[model samples]
Target: MIWADFSDFVSHSRQHFEEGLIRAGYEEVDGGWSGQVEHIAGRTEIIISLPPRFPFVPPKATPANVADVPWSWHRERNGALCLVADDDHDGLWWREAPAFLEHIAAWFESCHGDWKDDRPDLDLDRYFHAANDDRLYIYGDLEAYRGEFVRFGTAPNNAMVMKGRGTRPAKVSKHLRDQFGYVADLGTVDVPPRNWKDLLAHIDASGYLERKIRERLIGLLVLIYQRGDHEGTTFLKVTPTSNGGIDVRRLRSGADTPAARSARSGKDSVELGTRGIAVIGVGAVGSFVADMLIRAGVGRLTLIDDDVVMPGNLIRHLVGPEAVGRPKAEAVKDQLGRQYRLRDDQVEAMSQNALTSDVVFQVIQNHDLVINATADFAVTAFLHAAAQAAGKHVLSAALQNHGDTIRIDVLPPLAGARPLPASASPENHQEPTYYEAGCGSPISPTPPHTVIETAAVTVRHAIGLLLDEPVHPSGEIRQLKHTRNQ
Candidate 1:
């Protein structure tokens, strides 16, 4: 019996397998490739299995055990068989595969005509071009499909076959072996990943696992278990450990884990906690950046803003009437604490101006990134100079009124080299400036049309910057229309 299966993606593994078989003078007989199937041809039988991911990630494939097969022929003792040219990133297997096969037949003929025992070394140029051509096969490239993958395959006649094993089988084909990138050969039966506990929990709880939906569900579960439990929300600290170990303790939190009650209920302390963000403002724009930095998973946050919330700011500021008269830093801290479920120690609040000699500057030195979200031009200039001299990345967002219209600007770090200090050439430096009022109204009688169009654009601009995606400013904005004026 012969078995063959395609990966869940057009990865390097499938490319390696198909290219290997094709180079061996074997032609796919059927409709491309199939998964987890067996075909019997006389006394010979072969089985195939694919791992969860392919290409950027590899799948696990092992041979089935037979009653009487030579062990040496079945499994190599020394020199492991890794997927085709896994060491080289510029190979066909590393690239997408759908279109790569178009010229593969010609490539196979050219290479095999000379009978080279070893596979030919590929030039980086030819490999990248072939790999890039697979884009024609991808449906669409968008954020919705980030970290997503798909798979398809075919078994050719007189070339390869598919077979199913009853638990264990012997003598796996090199084709399957190379496709999965196995060092030697997968063991008798493909061992379900240890993370299968969460995978099974998902399927059993959900009651249905369509082949299409299973991969996505598993990926989601992995993400939840990774971000929610095992690793805290800090981006830099959220790295996976070696040994494929899952920090189960990190994954299970709150009601999900029974041990939540056993953990300390007081302030949660992080190591080297003194070094963290010190936000100088907590206005609408500033609050949004704080949220972005937090969601970007900054480990620690220290807020310093002296302004007290007023009733008018309730419309735009994240705080409200109940927070009126309260210091902005404390208000933001209290609000974010609710959203992120921050422990007492993860956040600290202070009320003050961010002047040069101010304690806030001392706190700012500890942070990795400083954001100047203040509307005051003087404050912005000081922050720009101070942060630049300290070699820190500064991000700021602002809105300018164009008479019934608002244009949002997101100033990222300067390109190429860091900006020189204002002290170096005081004459050459200009103060940071913007012409927007605290009330967020245009300086003149603005047209309602421009107001409607620009307001929508400003919100979208702000969000795109927060999401760290590219955004075009050609009068683009998020729209808000009245539906019969409720």
Candidate 2:
């Protein structure tokens, strides 16, 4: 039988008057809650009544049973839910109405078959008297209705705030505005007006005008405008039980105004870093290529690889022992992330191998320059085919085993160059590959190591190539061939 609290039933009173049933005290039945209803199908009946908190709270219910069952309904044992007594301050009274009706309905059916006189109130016809005695009112017509709540943006005052880089957490709001002499418009949050004249006028012409604060203010204003209205006034109000993200109650759905659009476009472009470069593979040589590009002021560096640093690589890799186990891309990014002059976002890390032409093509298509540092033949072949097809400039480098010599090549679009046959001698190849043999071996862990020393030279050359600067001592290829019969 369902038993809804009196106070709760009235608050949730909907237009429909659904049925309710009282319970049979917390008793364990063989078939569960569903099966208990079958047991009392013939002997018991119920009458649902609405309390003051009608629709918003559970409804009130009383059951009448004749098949000799002595029992009273009780709440479920687990943790208390919305419809349970613990959820209500008035002791299961002012909860919700519909929930009450549901409980009563289940209890009425439970007492029919498991008839026992030892149970309390075995009177099948007397249950309806409780509803009549309390004079519980019936809400809307006994009809069913279903609806749901929809929220836009964040709800209430809940907001997600990201601290700007180098921004200290001191009185952020006041300090930012006071120092920068800018105001964070908490209004509609659309687009901030360009006229900082008013805020500037309000600034104390003395101690408040520091360069650092002024710089932060300008940066913050630009950032806010870039985020546009969505991140503005939208706040979420959520309790622990809420679903999805924070709820947003206020919505601004109108199209962007011309001024807002222009401001947003300008702000957005400046914030997007560089979107036209891909770095495939961040291995030994690849890292050098990326470093050269970054130092030469390349637009951005998008790195891709699926390998992690291992202990054995401590000898030759640019990264140190601290970065031993990190993904190469991430390690590269971590190193670059600390470089204040560099655009951190520009150095992305794709934790996957550049295995196919398609994979190379997808990344190359979006970038103006493709730097293949992976030093893998499969990856190199894919890069050549894809970058050549897409007309993207490709730079690839490799080194012979240990420290024989280094090879760096610039592959522009195929253009008018002679194409080699599917099968051709190494000498007949149009593009030259530097095959350095026994130039120098790396000195073990000491300062005058060959790998450490030569790497510096090769990286400088790469930088010159990227920046179109003059190469020192001419950028000609050198081959260290072995002489026989001396």
Candidate 3:
């Protein structure tokens, strides 16, 4: 009856699993099965325990004499063998009992060879036991301050590392008050210390800290050490042992620098880091456009809007219900900052209407490009005139045909380039039905997918203009009638 619960066992019968285990020299145990695997390092007794969910989850394997096995990259702190990377989704091994046992054998073989062919994993924090606390330490560049003491500010659940020991920088102190600092030291080894004894031995041998300094410290200690060719961080908590030795435990830590965030994009992000842009409107389409530009590595942004987030906006807006009553521009800015770890100077929010603001021309002149997503004819005309006077490029995008069509217009900052004719407007097509929301003007029905699709096309052109790529002078218009049913 237990086999009936799992479809996999029905196909490869429970009797087959028993026969496979017996042939592999394994015996049924009280919880699961046990077997001994031979490797170059001798024999290891592996115990595989099937989870309650059976075939839905993979069986967990661990050594019977866990303490006797040496630490390696493929071993977890809880003694379970890490058979695959965290992101691996292949289900071949867990589909049946025989394949699962074979995976365990391969893991032991890899351990025997010392994992020399394994790719480098810069995160060394996983090898050791973490402290009980949940506080996370966020740091920036520390290459210049290696071997020197640095200050940090404490918040509710996290702390920020600041450089130097003098008066705390006004920019950081405003958000987080100064709590404590740590000494940034470079380690000699690329791998993490095996255990508390190994860590204490390294500290004594390196002479990075004196007895008085180590004893005076009361909390977490951060080490900015080298890992192969790159850098890595390690957080440790040191306490005195009964034998006069020190016990060290690793803590959670992360890097928050611009270089760390943009490392995924490689060289493509380098040019965009120096570019700035201003967006007029933070509605469904505009919010997504701003978010995409930030993720693409645009260094600076100015968000301008006069509307506030309403409950109805949540269907397509970038923000959540928590930002319902807040200004659209400020909410979008906060959302982008939390997602990208942007500083205050990186994003500026202006809760003023661009059409009515007296300094709208100043904003246009400050950025490399301006994006208009207000979908208002009057606002579009006003922005085009302002961009012309300021000698800047303006990109306008809108959804038409009840969200089935997307229109994008580009006005280059050239002497002879002019705006597209009025025929380009959706108003020239069949009139769209509008739904009333009780108080304000009637709104057209545009689904979330159409808004996202429009934003993608609009941002593609914006990035092309910023990177000086060739673009059509009149811009592009796309029809999505075939995809409307979805």
User: Estimated TM-score per prediction?
Assistant: 0.35, 0.35, 0.66
lDDT of each: 0.40, 0.43, 0.73
- Give the runs in model 1 whose Cα sits over 4 Å from its true position: 1-275, 388-393, 402-486
Candidate 1 lands at a TM-score of: 0.35
- Residue 354 local lDDT, model 3: 83
Candidate 2 weakest ten by summed lDDT: 139-148
Q: What is candidate 3's lDDT per residue for 226-303, written digit by digit as tens?
A: 655666777766555667665667777777787778887545578988999988988999999998888888889999
Better by lDDT, candidate 2 or 1: 2
Could you give the C-alpha RMSD of every candidate to the true structure, in order shown? 20.1, 27.8, 7.5
> If candidate 1 were superposed on the true structure by all CA atoms, what would the RMSD be?
20.1
For candidate 2, the lDDT comes to 0.43
> Which candidate number has the best TM-score?
3
Specify the poorest-scoring 10-residue window by lDDT in model 3.
164-173
- Residue 401 lDDT, candidate 1, scale 0-100: 37
